[model samples]
Target: MPRNAAQTEIYDALGVGFGPSNLALAIALSEQPERLRTRYLERTRQFGWHRDMLIDDATMQVSFLKDLVTPRNPVSRHSFVAYLHQARRFHSFVNQKTLFPTRIEFHKYLEWAASDFEHLVRYGQTVTEIGAWQDQGAVTAWAVTATGPDGELSTTLTRNLVVATGLTPSLPAGVRTSRRIWHSSSFLSNLRDWQPPDRPRIAVIGAGQSAAEITAHLYKQHEAAEIYSVYSRYGYTQSDDSPYANQVFDPQAVDDFYYADQQTKQSLYRYHANTNYSAVDQDLIEELYRRQYSDTVSGRERLRVVNLAKISQVREIGDKVRIELSSPHLDGPLDVDLAIFATGYRPMDTDGILAPVLSHCDLGEDGRPLIGRDYRIATRPHVTAAIYLQGGTEASHGISSSLLSNTATRAGEIADSLTRTGRAATTLPVSVPQE
Candidate 1:
C-alpha cells in the first residue's frame, strides 16, 4: 500500500557512512529513487576510502571484473566502464593493457559513484546515535542523531536504517604512534612531511602486501636507506587467485555462504580468508623475493626480512622511533630506528548508541546481530522496521561484507527489499515547510 500524504512525520531510510559499501547503496537507490526513500550521512566533507594510504604504486587487490556494478548488471549505466567512458579515459585505459586498475583509478571510480547521487548524500555530518520509537511491541520509527555543518545538532526520524559505519584501523595493543612511529594506513599522508638524513634504517612490521609495498617504496624513494621487514610468519603467504579458487568470490557464492550452516560458514571463511589478508599477491611476492635475492648477491643487504620475529615495544624519542623485536627462536633482542605496523582494521561497533535498544533486536551467542540474508538485523517481536547492515555483515552474510566483490549486488538487493516490503511517506506535512 502507498503511504498516506497526510502523515506529518518525515520518513527516511538513512545510510550511516558514505564509503564504497554505502555509496553502492546510494547508487542503487538513485537508479530507482521513486521506490526507496533514502539519505546517506557521511562524517567527512566528501567521499574517500583510505586516502592516506593511496600509495602511488599500489593497485587494487581485485580485478576490474569485480567493479561496483559489473558482476550484477554489466549493462548498468553505473558500471566502472561507464565511469571511464564518462571521464573520457576509455582509450587511455585500453592502452594500459592491465586487467587491474591502480589504486588511484579505483578511488576515482568511487568518487564518480558518489557524485552520481549527490542529492542523497549529506556530507560533513556524523551519525552519533540511533534510537527506536516503541508503539506497542513494534519499532515504529528510528531516531537518528546527526551533527551537521557549522557545529549544529539535528535529529531526523526514519522508518529504517542502514548502518555502514566502516572499519577502524588497529595497531598492536601496546604500540603507541607518534611523530616517528606510524601505521601503514597513514604512510603516504605522513611520509612527505617526515624528513631524515640519507642511509637511515627503517623497520616495517608485517608480512602482508602493504608491508612489502611500503618496503619497496621506501627503498626506491631513499636510495641509500636500509629496510628491515619483520613478520611473525616465516614467509609471506601467497594469495590463491587461481581460476578455481577465485570462483569462491563469484556472485553465486553469496547463496552458498548464506545457505550454509554455522559450521560450514566458518569453514568457508577460514578457507578463503587468505584471499584478502594473511596473503600477498603472487607477482608481488615474487618481485619482493627477487629484490631480496639481488640484494644478497650484491652484498649490499639493503633489504632484510626478519621472519618469525615480532616487535615487542616501540618508544619514540624526538624524530626517531626505537623498536624492540623479540622471538623465542632468536637468541637476542634486535632494535630498529622506525616501526611501521601494517596491521588491518576492525569493524565499527554500534554498541554505544545501540545499547539502549539491544534488547529489542535478536543477537547471536557472540553478542553480534543475527543479520538476515538481506543484511537486515534480526529483531525480536518488536522493531518492525528494517535495520540494514553493510560492513559488519560478514558474521552472518559471509566474507562479502567488507569485500568489494558483492557491493553493487548487495545494494540492489537491499533496495529491492525495502521498496517491495515497506513504504515510507515522503510528502511533507501541511504545516511544515518543504526543503
Candidate 2:
C-alpha cells in the first residue's frame, strides 16, 4: 500500500524515543506555562523499559524518590509517589519501609505516568533518519523521517531534536548470538521460546547485575538444571550504594563532572565505577552465596561458579553449545543447553542516524559529539536547531548520564534550555520537501 502523503509540522521539539528519559521530558514540558509543540516517537508498539529483564522478584537499585519528576519537582503529578497515591497504593508502599520498589511495580508507575500524555507520543514508529532542514545556508530545523509498523512513511520538521534512543545490547568480540546462545537483554523472551531438556545445563557469562540475576533465575526455574557462571573476577563484587558514594548521581555532580578536564572525568568514572558498572547488589550477592552453600551442604552441586575463568571459544555442537573454559583451575570444555552473555551494553551511537546533521555538530578530540552542560549538541552557531542527547554523553556528563537516578533532573534541565532558546516560537505546521 502507498504511504498516505501527510503534511509535516514544525514542532518545538521532536523526541526520538519515548522511554523514561523522554517521558520525563514530556512531563517537564507539560509543567511549563507556555506549552511547547512536542511529539515523541517510539519504535515499540507501547512503552516498556527493559521488559525482558523485569525479573519477578527483581527490585530497583535506586530509591523511589528519584522518580520521573521528584528530583526535579517534588510537587509534580507525574511522580511515583503521586502515581502510588492515585492507584491507592501509597499507604501500602509506605508500610513496606523499603527504599527500592519492585521492578514490576516501578514499570507500572512508569506506564501510569506515560498514560497521561498518550496524545504526545506515537508508538511503533522507528526513526530511520534525521536530516537537517537548511534555510539560506543555515540549518534552521530538522527533518525527522520515521516509518510506521504498517510500512507507512512520515516526516516531521522540528526546530529542536532530543535523541533518547537509549543503549544497545553488546556482546563480546568473537561471540555471536544464535538460537542456543543469547544475551541477557533477551533472557525472558528467549527462555519462553525454548523448552529445557530433562537435565539442562546453562552458562551465564559476565559478572554484572544482569548476569547474577539471570543465574539466579535459571537456578530457580529449572530445579534439575546445572548453571555455570563464568567470570574473571573471583566472585561477584557488591555494588557500592553507600551514602557518600551515591552522591555521584546527584544533579550537582553533573555540573562538577561536566566542567572538569578529560583526565579528571576518566579518573572520576574509574573511581566510581562500582556505583553503576559491573557490580551486583549486596543482598543478591548474599542470596546467591546462600544458595551455593545450601547446594554444597546437600551434596547437590547444580550451581557452579567458574571464577577467574575466560571463555576461550564457543561453538555450537549438534544440539548443544560447547563453551571452552580457560583458567588455571579448570581444564576442559563445558557443554550447555544455552550460553547467555550478560556482558552489558554500549551507548547508542548517533553517527548513523544523524549522518546528515553530524557535519554541523562539533566533535571532541576523541571524535565523540561535543555535548554542552545543558545536554545539547554543540553545533555550529548558524545551525540554530538544538540537538540534545538524553544518553550517550557519559564522557561529557558523568556516571549518571545513562542512569535513572538523574533522569528527572536532566529532563528538567533540557526543558529549561529549550524554553530559553525560544525554539517554540513557530507553532504552525509546515510541509516537508520531497528528497
Candidate 3:
C-alpha cells in the first residue's frame, strides 16, 4: 500500500463500481505483467453484492465453476475453490457434491476475492458525472466526478473508464414502494425482526425466482400468515438450464451473438428469455408445489396460489394495502397487510453519468450506445479515452452482459482490450510511482 493517500496523475483505468465484474477486472489487471494504475469507486461504505437478498439456504443459479477467476484463469488463487481451500472448507464442500453453493457462501467467496484489492478501492464514493478531459486543445483522458460521504465532489482522470455500476431495481408501472409495499431487493432487510399479525394476508407479486424464494421463505418464517403468490402466469415457469440451451451463455456465444443480424439477435433473445427472465428453478417450483399440496392435505391451507391474476391497482389504506385483481377468480380487491413485489431489475442506464460525454458516442436507432465486441463504446475518432461497459450490453453482446455467468471471462477480455489500446503503459509528463 502507498505510505500516503496519493493518486497517480492519470490512471490507466478507473472503474466506477467495486462489484464482481470490476473486481474481476482488478484481479486481471493485477495478474498481468504490465502495471496499469487502476482504482475502483464504490458507493457503499464497504463491499457487498446483493447483501439484502443473500438468503441462507438459497443457492446460486450459475455453477461455482463460473466464479470470479475460474472462467478466466482456472488456476488463479482468487478462484472460489482456492478460497474454500484457504478457508479449510474445500473437503467439506466437495462432500456436498453440489455445483451451486448457498448465496451466502457465494457472497463470502466474492468478498474473499475482493479483499485482495483493497489498496486499489475507495469506498463510499458515488460517481455523478463523466466527461472528456480537454487539455492543450486535445482530449487525453476522462474526468470522472464523484461525491464523497461528506457530499464533497472530486474528480479523477483516467485514460479508460469501465462502468460496472450494476442494475437498477424495477417495479411495476404506477406502483411505488412504501411502508406496506416493497421490492424483493430489500426483502430480508425489510422483514428483519418484523412479524405480521396472526393469520395475516400477504400478497407476493411476480413469477420470477425471487418471488418463489420469497414465498418459500415467508411460508417457513410465518407459519400462521397466509402467503398469496399472485402472478400473471398460471404457474411458475421452470428455467431452461439444459446443457444445450445453456450454450447461449458461453464465451464464444457472445461473439456469435454480436456478429449475427438484428433479426437473428432478437429471435435468440426471445427464445432464451425463459432461461433467466421471469423464470424459476425447477427444484424450487417443486418445493413450493409440495408445500402447497401438503398444506391442502391438512385441510387448512395457508399457502394460496393466485394464478392468472394481475394487480391492476395497488392502494394503501391505512394499515393494509388493497390490491385490485384483474383475474376472473377474484370477487373483489384483496386486502393484504403486506405486499412484496419481486419484479426483477432493469439494465444499467449510462445516461446519468455519460451525459457530458454522450456527444462523442455513437447511438443506435434506440438511442443506446453502440458498443463493440470489446465492450468499448464506439466514439468519435478524436476522443481517445476508452469507455467500456460491464453491463447493459445485451443488445450487442448477449444475455450474460449483466449476469455473473460471464463476468470473469468478460473482465479478462476487457483487460485485454485495455492492454491492446496501449493504455496499460504508465507514461506521462509526470512519472507514476511504482508499487
Candidate 4:
C-alpha cells in the first residue's frame, strides 16, 4: 500500500469500484465546473476489464462507437477513438471497417483511459463496510471502511457514495469449485496453472457465449484432449442482435423501462431476455457446428456436444471428477478430468454492504432497493447524503445497467444529478492527495 496522509479529509464523492462504470463516473465528474473531491477504491492491483476471459478472437458485443464516453460526450478524451488516435491506430482501425473490436483491444483501451485517473483511484483496497453518519437524528454522510493490501484498515468519509463493485460470478446450487472444478470467469488463468494428464477430458457447462468460446478454445489449445459441452438447451442459440431488438439497449429505452409499471418491467425482461442471456454469436455458433460436423465426417470426434442434458451431481473421484448426466438419452455417470461452469453472473446486491444503513433507505415490495431514475437510492427525507448506484439496477434501469452499453451515459446522468442537487461541492479543508 502507498503511504497515506492524515486520515481527516472528507471527499464529496467516493466510488467503490474502479471498473469501466465508475471510471466513466470519474471522467464525468471531471467535466463538472466545481471540482468534486472524488476518490475511487479498487480491489485489483491495477486496472483490468475481464482480463481472464479476454480471448484473442472474441470481439465486443457492442459497437465501437458506444465506447466509454461517446454515448455521453463524444468529444471526451477518454473515448475509444481518442485512445486509438493516441496510439496512432485511428486510421488503421478505420481501415479495418469493423463495428466491433477484439476483446483484448477493448481491455487495452480501458487501461489507457484509467491511467488518466490514477490520482483519484487507489488500487489494492477492498471495501469491507459502509456506515452512515448521523447528525441531529438525520444521516448526513457516510464512512467507508476498506482493507488495504497489507491488511491495514482505513476509513474515508464522503458525502456521496457510488457503489459499482460489479457483478459476482455464480455457480450452481450445491456445487462448489475445487482443483478439478472451475468457473469460466477464471478459465484462462486456471488452465495455465493446471497440469493435465495425457488425454484430458473436460466438460464445459452452460449454453451461453462464454461456454461456447471456452469449448472452442479448449478444443484448439489441447489437441489431445476431449471436450464435452453440456447444456440443457437443444442447441446453442444465436443472440438477438437484430436492429429492432437492439433498440432495447438504447438510451431512450432506459427511460421507458424506468418509468414503466412493475408488470411492464417483468414483461420487458421476459420478452427481450435473448438479447443478453444464454445466447452466442452467429459466427461462433456456426464455427462450432462446422467443427462438430467435420469431426463426424472424418470419424475423429474430439468435440462432443451433450445437449438436452443436465448435470445432476459432481463428485470428486481419485484423480478425476464424476459428473452424473441426467437426460432422456443418457444413463450412467460420466467421468471427466475437469468441469467448467460458464454459468452467467448476478448483479452485486447492496444488502450485504449496506446492511448497517439499510434502515434509512426505502425498499420496494420485492425487498429491493428503491432506486430513482437518476440512479440514487430513495432514502428517508432526513438522510441528506446521496447514495448512488452505478450498477445493479437492471430491474428499474434496464438490461444495460450492468453492461458497458450505457456506462458513459449513466455516469453523466449521475454527475448531472449530483451537480444539480448541489452535492458536488465539498467543504473538506484538505487538498486531494497527489499520485
Listed in order, each prediction's TM-score against the native is: 0.90, 0.96, 0.95, 0.95
Which number leads on lDDT?
Answer: 2
Against the unseen true structure, what C-alpha lDDT does each candidate score?
0.77, 0.89, 0.88, 0.88
lDDT per residue as tens, model 2, 110-167: 9999999899999999999998877777777888999999998888778899999999
Encode model 1's per-residue lDDT on 372-391: one tens digit a residue: 88888888875566688887
- Model 4 spans with C-alpha error above 4 angstroms: 1-7, 422-435
Clashes of each: 1, 0, 0, 0
Clashing pairs in 1: 139-383
After superposing candidate 3 on the true structure, give the runs of residues whose Cα lies further than 4 Å from its correct spot: 1-8, 193-195, 422-435
Task: Flag regions of model 2 displaced more than 4 Å.
Answer: 1-6, 424-435
Please rank every candidate by lDDT, starting with the best: 2, 3, 4, 1
Better of 2 and 3 by lDDT: 2
lDDT of 4 by residue, 179-227 (tens): 9999999988999999999999998999999999999989888999899
| Candidate 1: regions farther than 4 A off | 1-9, 149-151, 317-319, 328-332, 424-435
Worst 10 residues of 4 by lDDT: 424-433
